[model samples]
Target: MSGYFVTEGSKCKGRPLTTLPVVINRDLSRIINNNLQLKSSHDLEHLRYIAQQRDEWTKLTARIQEAAEASQSEH
Candidate 1:
């Protein structure tokens, strides 16, 4: 769910940034897109790091089974 929201927000945010360079100058658009690509590559690496951390957490917590059982019992 958080991923979906972030992707939607990025789509909206990217539109104006991309449109601005295109409206101002053709060459500028290429430069802006290249920078965006580099930023996206970094973002991908960051997300992978986050996923690794999450997997570590799951290992530490026994795959969250305790929390799930507690929630089920509460209901």
Candidate 2:
């Protein structure tokens, strides 16, 4: 468990810290694809989903930046 963290829950999950970038990339790609398929921004539901995705993207970007800074400082 040296390079892993266990999430607290009934079905405890563990994943390597290094895999975070891959997950973020996958999520961002999915969001971009969804947005690319949008024909119009008039639908309220679609607008809400887009807003949510934006927030997720922002958070992921921050996390990635933080990770990069941490890694840099470790040198």
Candidate 3:
């Protein structure tokens, strides 16, 4: 998925706002699922990595939600 940010604003009146293109890597679904499976299987070797993946997934989803809210507010 993708996101947008309003980077700059017009100093004068009747001018458009400047938007910056923000790209988000949203390809962690499979990885997250795999991590969940590993955890369910009681795999202790990669527990640290699995926890990290879960945290990253959480942050990514939160950012997605924030972006959606921002877009709605813009409209």
Tell me the tens digit of each residue's lDDT in model 1 across 26-66: 32223322222222445445434645897754553343455
Considering TM-score, where higher is better, how would the candidates rank from best to worst? Answer: 2, 3, 1
Q: Which candidate would rank higher by lDDT, 2 or 3?
A: 2
The candidate maximizing lDDT is: 2
- Collision pairs in model 2: none
Clashing pairs in 1: none
Which residue pairs collide in model 3, if any?
none
Model 3 ranges off by over 4 Å: 1-52
Candidate 2 stretches with Cα past 4 Å from truth are: 1-52
Clash count, one per candidate = 0, 0, 0
The residue-level lDDT of candidate 2 at 75 comes to 90
**Cα shift from native, residue 51, model 3 (Å):** 10
Q: Model 3, 1-75: lDDT tens per residue?
A: 012222357455775544321112222222333322222213333434544798865765565576666667989
TM-score of each: 0.27, 0.33, 0.32
Lowest summed lDDT over 10 consecutive residues: which window, candidate 1? 29-38
